[model samples]
Target: MTSAALPPSASVTVRVPAKINLELLVGPPGADGYHPLATVFHAVNLFDEVTVTAAEEWGLSVSGPQSLGVPVDGTNLAAKAAQALAERAGVDEPVHIAIRKDIPVAGGMAGGSADAAATLVACDHLWGLGTTKQELEEIAGGLGSDVAFLLSGGTAMGSGRGEILAPVLARGTYHWVLALSEGGLSTPAVYAECDRLRGSVAVPDPVPTPEMMQALRSGDARALGAALQNDLQAAALSLMPALTDVIDAGLEFGAVGGIVSGSGPTVAFLCEDTESALDLAVALTASGAVQDVRRATGPAHGAHVIGGPRPG
Candidate 1:
C-alpha cells in the first residue's frame, strides 16, 4: 500500500526580547581588533517578533515603531541568519521574513540580534530543519556577539568577545525605565571612542563584580540596582554628552540607578518596583530628557515560537 503524502510545512513566528547589560566590563582590544568583554546580560520584556514564511524568493520586510532604521536587504542580521541557516542545512528554499520591532534599533538593546535569534528559530521550524539548539547557537554566535545571548535570553554571563555564555542564577524580576534618544548611537563608533579615551592606559581584564552576582542571587532589586555598572558609560557619555543629562534626570526622578545601556544613547534606569518604574517613566517623559520612555521588566525568556503553526 502507498503511504499518504506528508503535509506542507507551516509558517512560524518567534518572539525575542531585548537586552540590557547589568554589568559590562570591557578589556583591551584583542588581536582580532575586537574588545574582550565580561558582561552580565539581562533580557527585558521589550520584544521583536519575526515571522517566516516559505517563498519563491528570499525577502525581508520590517514594520513597527522602531523599524524605520532597519535595513530590509541582506545586510540585515535577520536576513543573514536565514541565509546562514539555509546554507548550513543545504536547503535551496527561499523564505520571506517579516519583522515587527518594538526594540530600539541600534540603541544597545540588541534589537537586531534579537531579530536574528528569532529568525533562526522561526526558519528552523518553518523549514523542518530540526536543527539542534547548539547548532542554532553556533550560527547565532557567527552572526553577532549578542546574538548568542539573545538565543538563550534570561540572565547570563558573557565573555570572550561576549559570545561565550554561562547562565546566571537570579531570583526576582527587575523593573527598568528606558529613555530612548532621538537618534541611535553607532556601536562601532562608541567602541572606537572607548579605545581613544583609554589611550596610553593599560586596559585591564574585564570582570563582573562579586556584589553584582550576590545581588542577583538574593533577588534584591535594591542591591542589584546599586550594583549596576557599565564600562562603556564613560565612552558613551563622551560621545553623547546629552546622555549624562538623561541619567541625571532619571536619578533626580528617584531612579535607584541609571546607566548607559551598552554602547548607547539609550539610558536604562533601574527602579525598586513596578510603581517606581512607572513613576520614573512618567517623570523622564515629562522632563523631556529623552525622546521616549518605556517601562520593562527583566529576566524574560529568550527567542521562542509564538502561537500555533499555520498551514503553508
Candidate 2:
C-alpha cells in the first residue's frame, strides 16, 4: 500500500497461506443460514500466490499442481474479489489476475478464500489505491468467512461466521501431516449434512476452549492435539466415511492428535516435531488410505506483497 506512486502499468504479487481450523465449534445456524463459530484458526505452509497486472480487459489464469479443477471464470472468488474492490474504490480499470494454486481446492482448507485475500492485497498495490487495512478487512469480511483470517494469519480466534478475528498468542511452531483425498468435499453440502444429522437437536452457542488456548500459549503439541475438536467432524465423516480410515491411520502412526481439517476430506495430524510429521506422512501414504500427504508447519504469516510494483 506504500507504493501509491507506482505507474499504472505496474504489476504486484501477493502470497497467502492456507488455514486450518484447529478447534471448530459450530453453533446453531442463525437467521442468515450461517453458523456462528468460536474457533481457533491456524495458518500453515500450504499457499496460493496471486498476481495482478493492468490489462485492456479483465482476465484470469491459473496454474500449479493443484490447478486442475480450479475455475478460470468470473465465478471464481478471486475474480469476484477484483470486481468488489474495483467497485469499492470507484475504479473501472481492468486487471489480469494470475493465481498459482498450492492449497488443495475444496478440501475445506479455504484455498479459494486465500486467493481472494491475495487478490485484494495485490490489486490494492497494483492499482496504487493506498487502501487502509481497516477497509481491506471490511471488504474481506464481505467476501467470505475465512478471507479476513487469510489477510492476518498465524493464530486467531474466529467468531461471527468466522469473519471477525482477534489474534491469539501461540508460542511455538507446530508440525502437521495433511492427508489429502482424491476428491474434494463441498462445504455447503457438509453444512447441510450437519444440519440433517442434528435433526431438531438444540445446537447451542459455541464457546471457548481454555485448554486449547493454554496449550497454544505453552507451545505444548500434545496438549493441543488432545484438545483438537470439530463439530463439523461428525458431518464430514458422515458424508465421506472413507476419511475415518485416514484419521485412524494417522493416530495409529503415533500422531499426537488428528482431526478432519475444517470441513474436510483432508485430515490434519498434529505431530510432536518435524521428524514426527515426516514419519506420519509416510505411514499414511503407505497405508493407501489417502491420495497424498503433505508435511507442513503452522503459524505462517498471512497474505502480503511478495513482489512490489514494477513497470511493465
Candidate 3:
C-alpha cells in the first residue's frame, strides 16, 4: 500500500490535545541551561486541529481561532515535521499543512509540540510512509520537551529535560476549568523568572514524591487535587501577580485546587465533576481573572486524523 495508487493524495485532519503537568519539579539548570525536570503530564481534552494535504512544494498555512500569532513560513513545528519526514522517507512532493489552533499558545499546554505530533502521525498516513508509533515518537522527542506526551497521550512521568517517559495509571477523568490568558508567555522566560524569584541559585528536591505517584495510581480526585503542585508555580506567580486572583477565584468557586498551567498565565482548576467544572468556570469568568474560561477533562488521547476535512 505504500506505493500503490499514491493513496489518492488525500487530506487528513488530526486532533491534538494540550497537556497539563500534574506535578512539575525543576532542578538545577544543566550545562545547556535547561533545567532538569520530573513531571507527570496528563493529556487534556482541549485541543488544536491540524490538517495536512499533498502539494507541489512543502509549505505550511496556519489558521484558526488563534492562528494570527502562529508562524507558518517553515518555522512552525508542523512544517519542521513535514520536512523531517519527507527527507527521511525520501519523497520529493511537498505536504501542505493547515493548523487550527484551539489550545492557547504559550499557555504551558504544549500547543506547538502537539501540532508537530499531529502532523507526524497524519502525514505518515497521508503520505503512505508506514512509520510505526515508536519511530514517530523518536521524531516527536526531537521537536520539544513535551512532544512525546502528545504521542503517548496519557499520564506519564517525564524526566531528562522532560523527554524521557514512563507511563502512569490515572483512573477516572479529572474535570478542570481553564482560565485563558490574553496572550502567550515564553517557556524559557518562565523558567528564568523562577530562577529570578528564587534568586542566584537553587537546589533540587530529594526526589519525586512517593505520595504524588501513589495518588495518581489511586485515582482519587481529591487526592490528585491535593497533589497538584508545580515547582514553577511560584515563579509563574511571581512573574505575573495577576494570576493570583485567577488561582484564588477558582478555589473560591469550589474548585478543589488551582495552579498556573505549564508556565503561565493560563490557570487550571480541579473540580469534583463536570457540573462543578462548569460552575467554577462561570464564577471565575465573573471574577474577571482572565480573558475566557474552558472546561475540560484530563487523560484524553493524542492527535489522530479525522475522516472528513479538506483545505482548498
lDDT, model 1, position 228: 90
Worst 10 residues of 3 by lDDT: 1-10
Off by over 4 Å in 2: 1-9, 310-312
Cα lDDT tens digits for candidate 3, 212-308: 8888888788888898889889888877788887788788889887878888778889998989998888887888778999999988998777754
* Total backbone collisions, model 2: 0
**TM-scores, in order shown?**
0.96, 0.96, 0.94
Which of the numbered candidates is closest to the native, going by highest lDDT?
2
**On a 0 to 100 scale, what is the lDDT of residue 280 in model 1?**
90
- lDDT of every model, 2 decimals: 0.90, 0.90, 0.82
lDDT of 1 by residue, 196-291 (tens): 999989988998899999999999887888999998999999988999899989999999889999999889999999998998988888898799
**Model 1 pairs in collision:** none
Off-target runs (Cα >4 Å) in candidate 3 are 1-9, 308-312
- Model 3 vs truth, CA RMSD: 2.8
Candidate 3 local accuracy as lDDT? 0.82
